[model samples]
Target: MKIGDTYFSADVETDGPIPGPYSMLSFALVYAGQYDGQTFEKPSKYDQIFYREIKPISENYEVEALNINQLDRERLQREGASPKDAMNDAWDWVMSLAGETKPVLAAYPVSFDWTWLYWYFIAFSDKGSPFGYSRCFDIKTAVSIKANLPFSSAGRSKLPDWLQPEREHTHFAVDDAIEQAEIFAKIAEWKA
Candidate 1:
């Protein structure tokens, strides 16, 4: 691992309640211990983390998630790529990370992001996922069970021994990825 580098957290931000037929918009990767939540950051440094905004089919749109993005129109005009194109990019990114022992995807809400990505991969590739992995590790669930707390506990906990000093603004992709990373680090640190 290089010093002063982002920790290659894989993430996909979308405009929907669940990630299925919905378009993926505004993908980002943040460097841990670099810019992270401490400063303004963008997706220029993660060598293995790739992201793309895709135009979703009609069945993919979810009104609630669309409002969360707050950039549906702007993204459509600028960053929007076809679903196939974005999927291809993401698939390549996964292949690049094949070096990892278990080929992990760390995310806060794995149920949502993992499912959405799987659907897109199958649809885009016209086959099963190219990554050849069947399971994903949910960092949030790890943290929750490790500390024996609820998902909301992360927002309220403040003890460093329990967690890494309580991170804030953990809904967006980068921040959530960081949260997941924190849990992974702790798990590794304690040899759990």
Candidate 2:
């Protein structure tokens, strides 16, 4: 990879609360833009995007989770892409957009998304994880720090009007990803 770093806003919809035991139904990545270790910039339009729906690895799932993502489990079983293929394609797209810059995965709550993503990448892709083990950004933590609020208060409702996006946070992977990407940029560029 390159010497610099790029921030990739990522989101995933899963059938359950955890990886291994659950299945990731869909995932999306939005290359918000590069962060030169000091400054942040928004991408021009919808420049970088990656999205996929994967076949379930297990029969187990939660109805609430499915409802949240608005995905049809039966349809996914019949038409979803292979996990290995999807992960490979995702890695390729991330790499192409990153160029020489190291890709840094960012999520609203990194723990949940990172768990599924890292596990899937390692479990399915021979290329291993594109973001490696340590490169990750947590929007919640960043916003909490920037806003000088306690971590528990960093939820969306606590954010100021300027930081929150107007888009509805529909659980569709790509739409939520784009929404989170905007929030990430705002916090990253925030002076306070």
Candidate 3:
């Protein structure tokens, strides 16, 4: 039987502005819900999730970026999972969660998270990215269009009270992913 699309809300913490040059320090993917064309079934509990901290791929990094997420690169280099292992595990988890359905990566803006994830998956996973090269859902853009606001004004801080997520916006990758997933579900259910 054909199943619905499974949306995984994603968030990545990087050591710098981009991948390769810097590194994806950590990341998270939380299963939000499923949509079978007509109806969206939001997860009863946001417990289905995957998270990993990855060793730096390169020595290059920015101090400013590190200050934001506060991930110690040196410590990660010694204790974190290797890129190859992390990506492979993430790919496997995503596939298992999706089962027969198509998996879509959802994020607040999508561009930044997608960039890092796509690059890492291509560079590390033998099977490549689970979302292919493109399947992504941008919650920011969705809200902008749905609420008839300009893209610049779509940031979380400016969202209507009803559109704001109930979860706290901690910078931690998993926390942010869960928060964004909540926003995505609310957007999906909103009437406009």
Candidate 4:
């Protein structure tokens, strides 16, 4: 039996602007909730999460980008999980959570986070991307269209106070993912 789409709110902290040249320092996926076409069942607690910090794939990294997330590259280099292990574990986690439901990735912007995640999943995991190639929901775009605001005005800072998540926007991937999940839930239930 096919169930509703299971949304996973994702966040990635990277050492550079894009994947390939830079490395994804860490990433997190929070089981946002499930939508059964008629209603979105928002989870009471954003506790089910998959998080991983992986070793850099390349030596190239920007100091400024690294400073944003404050992930110690040297420490990660020594202790972080290998990309293959992390990605595979991520795939398993997503599948386990989703079960019969179609897994859908949700993110604030989606583009940046999806890009890194897709690249890493494809390059490392044998099972490949759990969300496939394009099953993603962009909270920014949803706010823009749903709220009848210009795309430029849909940034988190510019969004209506009601739509804002109570959680702080810490640079940590898991924290950010939970925050984004809350925002997505609000947007999904919003009438406008």
Q: What is the C-alpha RMSD of each candidate to the true structure, in Å?
A: 7.2, 1.6, 0.9, 0.9
lDDT (10s digit) by residue, model 1, range 26-100: 554333222222342333333333556566555456677766665564557565788777777766655454433
Ranking by lDDT: 4, 3, 2, 1
Error of 3 at 51 (Å): 0.5
lDDT of each model, Cα atoms only?
0.54, 0.88, 0.94, 0.95
lDDT of 3 by residue, 1-192 (tens): 547899999999998998989899999999999999889989988999899999999999999999999899999989999999999999999999899999999999999999999999999999999999899999999999999999999998998998888888888999999999999999988876
TM-score list, all predictions: 0.66, 0.96, 0.98, 0.98
Clash count list over all predictions: 3, 1, 0, 0
Candidate 3 deviant stretches above 4 angstroms: none
TM-score for candidate 4: 0.98
- Best model per lDDT: 4
Against the true structure, candidate 1 has what lDDT? Answer: 0.54
RMSD of 2: 1.6
Clashing pairs in 1: 6-31, 21-60, 22-60
Worst 10 residues of 3 by lDDT: 162-171
Model 2, 135-189: lDDT tens per residue?
8999999988888889999987678888988587888888888888889888877
Candidate 4 lDDT, 1-192, residue by residue in tens:
437899999999999998999999999999999998988999999999999999999999999988899999999999999999999999999999999999999999999999999999999999999999999999999999999999999999897889989899999999999999999999989876
